[model samples]
Target: MANFASTADLEEKKITFEEIAENVYAYTAEGDPNSGVIVGDDGVLVMDAQATPIQAQKLIDCIRGVTDKPIKYVVLSHYHAVRVMGASAYGAEAIIASQLTYDNVVERGQQDFDSEVGRFPRLFDQVETVPGLTWPTITFEKKMSLWMGKREVQLLHLGRSHTKGDIVAWIPDCKVCFAGDMVEYGATPYTGDAYLSDWPTTLDNLMALGAEKMIPGRGEALKTADEVKAGVGGTRDFLSDLFETVKKCVADGKDLTATYKETMDIMRPKYGQWVIFDHCMPFDVTRAYQEASGQEHPQIWTADRDREMWLALERDQSAA
Candidate 1:
């Protein structure tokens, strides 16, 4: 029986640094969080820093293998601890994020750190090295355009998907996009902090960008337009299916335990093998139940809340 989420996922995943576009690359490790690398004429831009300095160093080494250019920018897709906590290691000139993300860091960054570290200890290896909440040196309200020499990187918040602060890095030159946790390819979307009703529209905006190739928050790089569309559609389907099921269950006055069972029974066959599906579902359903019953923003998931919810949902799961 699983004791805690992703704690035993200690074995190193096979790392692949693939150049999907001319100067854009993806550093993927099995289904762990991915960081997109854009090597430009003058410097490099890193999207979604790994969980710790130790974790970030691996990507830095990978970057060194290709170019000796300095990393000039570290972009946070959202405020998740696993993605943003490692920003210090890059030693970049600027760390960039949406203003909402910056605000989220101020609000629940510490609680998120505690919650995430407890859930995925393997990813945050050498956790003590994390400097603290990664505050962006540059914060944008809606859109900001950056230049790494001649390459134009557009940071856009089309709408809220995975979280209120979700953003994507769009490179028009290569028609490649670095989609953060907003769109998971084969992996499950952790919508515990998501706006489920608005998520699909947010994904549509991603589609409208017409990115021929894209790197998702997790899973492998999408090398073709077809694969990019697949990622968006897959994420859309997952969110809609989840909300629809949970909404119906809530309207029928089913309790969370029954909701958990029915939703898992429905989702497991398709998404069971995806990374963190079991871990995310309980949280996902809880948030979905809240939203379906009228809560707007998701309630915070602290370490204490995490344990309580786990026991409430999965305490007897091992015996079953």
Candidate 2:
């Protein structure tokens, strides 16, 4: 009834390609999913491919303006379709991700692809260009490091937060981190497939990296230590508050619909201005509710589930 999820969000956002460090760049749209670029001596590595090959080409165009190096690697921070489906467009030598991420792809990749496309139609502009699931050519367990000539890019799966397989790409030389959905600046996190209880601790681990600059999953790149701290802190606060509120509602033996209402009443005033706040709340609260009720792993979100959940929690709300 509320136009479903992000279906009414049709306005295009202005894209920004800014260099946050010497060779590290952030490709961000106003509040859409952001991508990271690291230009190395011999080649380049891209973090978090956009939703489709056409969307990926826009990022490639921006990269071409800065360097002519071959896009040698594509790194997926997690298994979300929005972050990995466009990987084929890079034509990279290898696509890297955590082993858990690969497992997720094998398990529910198609369901997620269908689910996300239905939610955010604008982001998946050319969905037809995506070639099935984007499987990783290389998978790591905990951490791995790649030497881009003289620069060292370390990929670390700090902990489970945004998703079980979320990883951050750290550039030791520049102290810059490409933190995929694990951290967000002025954007409400989409935690439909998250481990809400483990998220805060993961944020703590992410902060311990001491990154002076960070490129978050969505929103602007954090260019200073203070900005980085704020971004991480903001994300932590949102997740903690939402999860805790949901936990309390569950402890009181409230139903999912009532729990959703109570959580919204508490969170909206504080996080109302964040991008996608409205769209994310229903899914975020539902997942939090499940976790608080003792569900360990997130259930896969198919298109039908998305609609059912929306109808249950958000049918009475104004259209997006």
Candidate 3:
């Protein structure tokens, strides 16, 4: 956690908000770094709860300040610990996720819980407050629909993007989407287990939704149609650039350390300052390198793997 770029040495939490469209909102922290809220007729649906119970309550408090509706559901965009471990705070009747995400939860939730908690210590200040691994009471395959009073909620799995079971909450009526890690506004997309080759296509499918407003996994909410497109395009651009550069180096028979160093040097002028750029480069390069070597799916990332990769990259950086 000491060298993890998420905190960049920060010791406290920061939160902010933006009104994306008519009834949609994004609660972003700097960035603690999950949780978005959508208000409907009956109550509210909390997307991606914070890592700990206390962090989750902060979001719930914000909801109370805005409306009195009961939180009817807690939606797990995926099984990442930072995004779903705070479920108990909502006391939601149903926790929902895709079948794939559920499988991921069952496969490695404990490891992720420990891993993320370690990487983002400040974000998980009240680690003991976590109720345990968060599980979706209801799981779906492709898509599902719901109503909050009169507003329509459509949850669709476009395809693999950030994770194997990545899903987006689309409000068709308002053309707003809560894209969890599938897109990031002015931030580096985390691709620890991402299907890099397929992510662009998944993004293309998101474009087909004609979303006018969007809440990316991190950064500020995109309020204009143009801005929304920019966010998606930004992620695609980064992914494409990453793979293309890494592929060339990989093909040139460069070692992992050398290839990662060269790729980062190439990407820096264009994207070095983007949020989480430093933190993501190690994992991103690792995945890109593997894919270039013909690994179809990305290998799973655990806390131990995170450290090993980080130390390897850091040593190379220092030597350079």
Candidate 4:
């Protein structure tokens, strides 16, 4: 059977730290989850902490290289364990997240932490360094603004796409946006906890921001408007096509196994080149199938569920 979810993905990715604007930066790897840095006059605000303390410290090193300012706030783009588990390492005054994200942390934080660690062991190096669950010191319903001296960073929850509480940090003056998992450059969207029907409209809200530069959740930074559009458009197209195909299969009364195989045959040709395509497809199609079959919210994924789903979808079908 295919090595269970990312277990074979052990090679370390090369890290890149690039300046997208005057003081705005993107800390990216080949295809690992990315973090965004906004160095204001007084302090720095980080978007998306890495998977563990050791990983987060690497991003901290990148920030220190450019500026000596204190890291005051760490904003969680969503409540995914891979993105929010490293909040403690920043030593920021306050960790911020949307109300929905906070709720998810309360609801499924430990399950997610356990599930992710089991799936992608390489990303959670020094996993013991993670302290319990990362909680938000401050939470907002829709939007809020944080100021570092004169610079204002607007945090807005655009809509439900990747998760119910996915937010983007928009710097109006610089026209730079730190789009979390809501937009990915060339990485496959992990829709295991996504709202597929609402994703396109959410992308519409993100497009209205008109950010000249953007730091996606993964992949390299988009330094120009055209690149930004392509990043957002690429993500939208992937979700659109995936959901559309899955919905058609469901309407045709295909079983989950049949739908999965059919969807893979179609999507693999187009999205196979994207990072994590194989690792994410089983989970992605399962969630899409659930949503298409009338489930409103995504079922929380546990480590047990991860293995069971992989075996059912990716292993030998006759044996399964």
Candidate 5:
């Protein structure tokens, strides 16, 4: 039997603060959820708050290490509990997210919080400090542009990849972008809340921005154009491969358990070394199965549903 995620990920990873562009930083911790920091002329814009308030403080420390600018904006790339809950620690002037993202929080934020903690307990080091669901003080529809003094940061919806509320911040002058969970370099993109059919097109829209440097949701920052293209392509391929496999399973009238096994067998060899492959594949396959089965909107995943699925799929199939 495979070790549960709890057992497999006990030790913490070393966090690195690397500057991908001038005053643009990527806070990556070995394949853990990442946060982006941009120090503009007047203030700072932080993309994706860490999992908890305590986890967020480490980011604050990194921001202070280089620039003393106050964090004026906090961007929510999506409505995931692990990404948005750390807004409090930033003490930013405003929290920004897509209108859909804010709606998602209103609809299923609490359920996601409970479910995610149960899956990756170590990521929420100080879960207690999270002050309930994080809300966006500002929201936009398709696209919105803001200025941190003279620098321009365009927040675009670009259809949907990871989630309905997914947004990516583009720094046109720097030719760098902060892609929330839209892109992953050496990490597996979690798709429990994804739109599988629309994801590839959304990725194309991301590439359309022509960002030479990019910060993936997880994994180290992509420093070159080739590296950036590879990250986007890798994410697109992973999603396509997983969804196609699930679609075939559904066509063959296979059950979720059988489908999951086949998916693991197919994806493991190519993405086995990628971070969170085992933990994410189960959730990814579940969502892909639903999409392939004709569900337009993803079903809300509560803590109870998370466990039921894990036991049904991740546990001993022989017993099942």
Candidate 6:
């Protein structure tokens, strides 16, 4: 009963950005989603591979332009296919992530890959180039630290925001955090599988890092502290306002259909232009509606469910 938007309208590919911060570098594209790169004396580490092997290799090409060091590690912030499916292209000795992420990868990685490939066909340009499901070689519980020769990268499971297994890569010396989908710049946060109640506190923990700059999950790299705050604040605000609106409707004993209609009216004006603003709302509201009604964890989205939800939401939205 969530009013969703279709992906049929988006069409274009743009160059990605690479921000050089002393030794660490952030490779961000125009919201095909962003990834990070850190160069150490002996090797290199990449955060979140692109959607397909071909796309990831493009990032590797960009990396080679900056440094010749081998990519020794690839870190996955979560189990989302767009972020992790490109791991094979790195040829790194190890891939690292949180235990929850690893488990989610094991539980739903294939399904996610199929669903995402269908959702964003343009992003996964060379599906055959994908070597298969990208699994993490090393997994951790709460926190993990890596020292690539002299540079230290701390991967912390700050708390669930975008997903239950979300992690952020912290480069202490540079005071920069590569916050994967946990934050986005000028883009709508996808709350389809989110923990809305916990997302803000997770943002609170991220702010405490005092990061001077940040590379969010998508869009441009945040250069100023205010930009960082804006990115996180925007997502938090959208989710908070959305949850409250949905909750009020539910409290009024409205059905899913009525609540979806009411929620859409409340969010469109303030957040209608963020990238994929329309495409992400249905899933966002669907999960928000469930969470507001006491569903602690979001249900996994299957291809059938994706279509069903899309059609149902589209029908309602079109009628209005």
Q: Taking the tens digit of each residue's C-alpha lDDT, what string does model 5 give over 213-245?
A: 998999999999999999999999999899999
Per-model RMSD to reference: 1.3, 1.6, 1.6, 1.2, 1.5, 2.0
Question: Considering lDDT, which of the candidate structures 1 and 5 is the better prediction for this target?
Answer: 1
TM-score for candidate 4, residues paired by index: 0.98
lDDT of 4 by residue, 1-320 (tens): 45665888899999999887888889999999999999988899999999999899999999999999999999999998899888899899999999999999988899999999988889998899998899999999988999977888999998999999999999999999999999998899999999999989999999998899999998999999999999999999999889999999999999988998888889999999999998999999999999999998999999888888988787645454
Candidate 5 error regions (>4 Å) = 1-7, 316-320
* Tens-digit per-residue lDDT, 25-114, candidate 2: 999999999999999999999999999998999999999999999999999999888888899999999999999999999889999999
Please list all clashing residue pairs in model 3, or write none if there are none: 41-148
- Pairs clashing in candidate 4? none
lDDT of 1 by residue, 213-317 (tens): 999999999999999999988888889889999999999999888898899999999889888898889999999999999999988889999889887688655
Cα deviation in Å at residue 90, candidate 4?
Answer: 0.9
Tell me the whole-model lDDT of each prediction, alpha carbons only. 0.91, 0.92, 0.85, 0.92, 0.90, 0.85
Candidate 5, 308: how far from true, in Å? 0.3
Descending-lDDT candidate ranking: 2, 4, 1, 5, 6, 3
lDDT of 4 at 313: 80
User: Candidate 3 residues 1-320, lDDT tens each?
Assistant: 33777646456647776566765778887644656788888789988887788888888888888889999999888888888888998989899999999999888888888878767777788799886899899999999997877888898989998888989999988888999889998888888778888999999999999999888898888888999989999999999999899889988999999998898889999998788788788888898899889998767678888888888788878888
Residue 286's lDDT within candidate 2 is 88
Q: Candidate 4: worst 10 consecutive residues by lDDT?
A: 311-320
TM-score of each: 0.97, 0.98, 0.95, 0.98, 0.97, 0.95
